[model samples]
Target: MDLQQRINAFVQLGTFLREISSESISKTSSSKFHNQIPQILQAAQNNNRWFTETNIKFAFASWGHALTETTINSWLSSYSITQKIPNTIAIIMAGNIPLVGFHDFLSVLMSGNKVLAKLSSNDNILLPFLVSFLVEQHSDFKESIQLTEKKVTNFDAVIATGSDNTARYFEYYFGKYPHIIRKNRNSVAVLTGKETEEQLLSLSDDIFQYFGLGCRNVSKLFIPKEYDFHPFFEAMFNKKEYINNHKYINNYDYNKAVYLMSNIKLLDNEFLLLKQDSGYSSPISVVFYETYEDLSELQTKFSEDKDRIQAIVGNSGIAGEIPFGKAQQPTLWDYADGVDTMKFLVEL
Candidate 1:
């Protein structure tokens, strides 16, 4: 399909998602796939317990909002999306969160490349179904998108996301080809001890969303040394219902017990645990905090460790920091790992 055709297809898909998530379908554009959403939601939850309907729908809503014509055009305006000899771009998607690999998929397609996608077993359902809708929108897409479980082969380039261990494997296997290989990265929030109650409550979303599984979820905090835990804990109370998720609660209990056994001092609010740690990747249901005597010093540390961090959430006036509660709601231009996928693709 041509570039405009591709853009139009995605715009329609965006409309479909917005309608499906809101259950206010009033357009015939998505009629073919409209009835399939409920079944897809159930099947996704059944296949991956972490893919609760709420999170999946939230993902849908996020993508729906992002895929609008205005946003898409604005994002693409800087690029010269000229039709080129199509290259096959194979994607190794991560299943940590719903549609985590979608931006890569969109990048490859929008750059006029063929998609040979290896869907993560934990998240194999949703993207293909959406691709089906795209194919229906324009028959040309039927030849452009291929989802597979077998070892991917014969691609011009590769984009893979995984843990540090799997990233090594990806490098070994796909290193000969042009590639973008991403490893484990976590987001962190900076607390100045002056944030309003509203901001802290919003920060809770950065912590609890997706059960803290996604890379964008804040796992670490940089707080002033004398910062009180009272307001932070109280704000976290907003998401106390996370305890109702059996899987989440199991992690909390297990981590809490393990920490207690080690005699590690912890601040517990019954539902969440806070521990002093120098590490970035905290366990699910636990957030690591480190006291910062100077925000400027911490900023320098972040600069040195940028590769290990996916995002920084705060209003500390730090360059490139994401606002609290907006970690999961990245704009189209927010490249993961700070690598520009479209630039890489088009230049190839």
Candidate 2:
């Protein structure tokens, strides 16, 4: 099928999802499109999957809804069609969260290449189920996509995602091919101290959505030294019902223990942890904070770590847009590591 046809297929998939009830998506019995998360989690524990079931659901929902056709088309249209499409793409999926490798998958397929997908054991459910739905909608997509349970080789190009450690392995193994090896990244927020109460409440979505497991989740905050964190804490407190889930409580308990044992000082309220740090990507529900003297200095610091940052949150007047609620729901132009993936694919 042509690229436009594929785009339409995706649009239909989104429509199909919207038509189904949340109960249907979460249901387990006799459903063609069921997410077999428990089984997938067990398999991942015994195999190569490195993420959790929660990660998978969040990634799929975020990308499926946020990355729309208009966005994809705009990116693709920016590239010159004189370049020939690559023939084969080996996509090494990241199990850090669910379906994190889907943008790579979409890029490869849309570029008219055959896709050899290495599923993260942690996310075995969503990708296969989504691909199945695509094939059910358009059988030709089956020819474009292939699932591999074995290690991959013999591809013209590669896109692999993993922690900073696994990135080296991907590089050494797939370096000969034209490849993009994505490493670890975290998101941060910069509070201008003039942010509205409305913005702070909106910012809470970026902090707590998906339990702060995705890379786009704001794990660090940049605020003026004199800025009082009380309003932010109060906002989070209002959303206490969100953390009433047993899973978040368990994470809070576990992380709280490690923090105390390690003698880390944290400003703890009822639901979140605000500690001091100069980095990004903290553990789930834990956020690091640092005071910046000026936006220029913060911008310079951000540029230095640009490769490791996925998105920047907060009310700072910066190049990246401020995302509210889930960090994973990035807009079309919200390239990972600031790379225009669709442009890369279209130019291939």
Candidate 3:
């Protein structure tokens, strides 16, 4: 199949996904993806506690809007997608968030390479369902896709996503192949104390979406000295329902107890905890915050440690910074770790 054919197939898949999301939620699914939603959602939830029906549907909605013809065309515009000898591109997915490695899969197929996906045990359900839809739309996809439970081998290149420790393992094993091995990274938001309540409310999505599991979810905040957090706390109240989840509550309670016993000062709202920390990766239900005096100095510091950051969320207008609420809604070109997956695949 040509690039246009692949794009058309994905567009069809996107439409099906969006329609099914609405219909399934309303108990009125007539579309192809509708009948399968229940089985997939149930399987996902059973495999991982974090994969609630709500989060799964949110993922569906995001991809449904993302995999459109316009977005696909725009993303591919800069590259020549041709296939003379299609290489096998193996993907090792991370299950922290649903369908996390799908962009790599899409990149490989769009560039006319075959995909050998080793599904993370934590994220076993979502991608395969979408892959089934793709195969149904274009039977040729069956030849281009492989889902394996065994160790990955016989691949021309590898794209693996994992934490820092696992990243070292990936490097040791897959170093010989053309690879994009990712490490632990987190997003951050900066506040100037001038943001409107609406903006802060939107920023709450950056912090709480996917229960703050995704790398793109903001885990840290930078605020001006002596900043008033009253408005920020009020804005984040929208996500107070997050406390209802036992896993999240357990983390909050445990972390809060640790801080209390250690006599570490913290700001708590009976749900979320804000601690004065310079770290970017915060525990669930806790947001680490640091005080910044100079915007230029902070920008410079972030630039030096760019690899550790996934997205910079704020209205600060820092170069390539993600807008207040857009940390989780990255475009096709928002390559993780600032590495272009499509470019890597095309070069491979």
Candidate 4:
């Protein structure tokens, strides 16, 4: 199939998957879908068919809209597919959040490159299943993608994501090729105390999605010392339904203990903790904080750690927009760890 046809197929798949209820989506557990992900990854690797319908649908819906043909055409028109696309790309996926490697997958495919996906062990199921489903729908896609569990070689370009520690390793190992290596990032929110109840409530999603495991999940809150955290706490407590999971409770207990033992002062309200620290990105139940006298001061402080800050919440004068609950639901333009994958793919 031609590139446009492939893009159409992806959009169709996205629509189909989006129609499936959240309950249905959740029911298709990674375990049940594990075997299929390899096929999906294979399709993506083989035909330069990057996007699956499920991913497109999620992306569109995540952005609170439908993917239009115009949008697809516009995106495709930006690239010159007259030349043969790159044959292969090696992608070392990250498991920090569900479907986090999708943008890279889409970029490689759309730019007409075969993918060699080093699937993250933590998320071995979803991408493969989605790819398999697309391949089943379109035979041509089957030739384009491949999923391999083994170490890969001889790729024109590489994209890998990992913690700050592993980024160095990826850079050293893959630096010879055109690569984008991601390091740790933590999202934070700046609370001005003047926030409306609705705004504070909305911020809760930024704090708690995926139990705050995703890099985009806020692990820090910037608030003035006198800021009354009760309203924020009350808003989050109302959504205590989210904390029902055992994993979150365990993080809460562990972090809570560390705080107690260290004698770190905290402001607690039933389900979450607010503590002071210079760092960004904490565990599920805890958030680090720093009081700022003004936005200028906050900006200066943030500038010093720009590499570690992913998404900033609150009323800060920053460039990037913030999305709620879908901390992992990046748009087509959302570059991972702020690196441009599309540009990287196109360059190759």
TM-score of each: 0.98, 0.85, 0.97, 0.84
Error of 1 at 47 (Å): 0.4
Q: What is the C-alpha lDDT of each candidate?
A: 0.93, 0.73, 0.90, 0.70
After superposition, the stretches of candidate 2 with alpha carbons farther than 4 Å from their true spots are 21-61, 67-69, 81-86
Runs with alpha carbons beyond 4 Å of true place in candidate 3: 23-26
Q: Model 1 off-target regions past 4 Å? A: 24-30
What TM-score would candidate 4 get against the native? 0.84
lDDT of 3 by residue, 163-218 (tens): 99999999999999999999999999989999999999999999988999999999
Weakest lDDT window of 10 consecutive positions for candidate 2: 48-57
RMSD of 2: 3.8
Please give, for residues 1-348, the per-residue lDDT of candidate 1 as tens digits. Answer: 799999999999998889877845633445658767778999999999999988998999999999999999999998898977899999999998999999999999999999999999999999989998898889999888999988999899999999999999999999999999999999999999899999999999999999999999999999997889999999999998999999999999999999999999999999899999999999999999999888789989999999999999999988789888999999999999999999999999
Q: After superposition, how far is residue 240 of candidate 1 from its true place, in Å?
A: 1.1
lDDT of 4 by residue, 1-348 (tens): 667767776776565445442435534656444334446444543332223334333433553233345665666675676447456889998765556777778677777788789887666666776687678668877777777767888777788889989999998899998888888989888777887777777788778665677787788888887888778888888668645556667778888899999998988875788888887767669888888787777777778888888877765554454644445555566565677677677766
Name the lDDT of candidate 3: 0.90
Q: For model 4, where is the 10-residue window of minimal lDDT?
A: 45-54
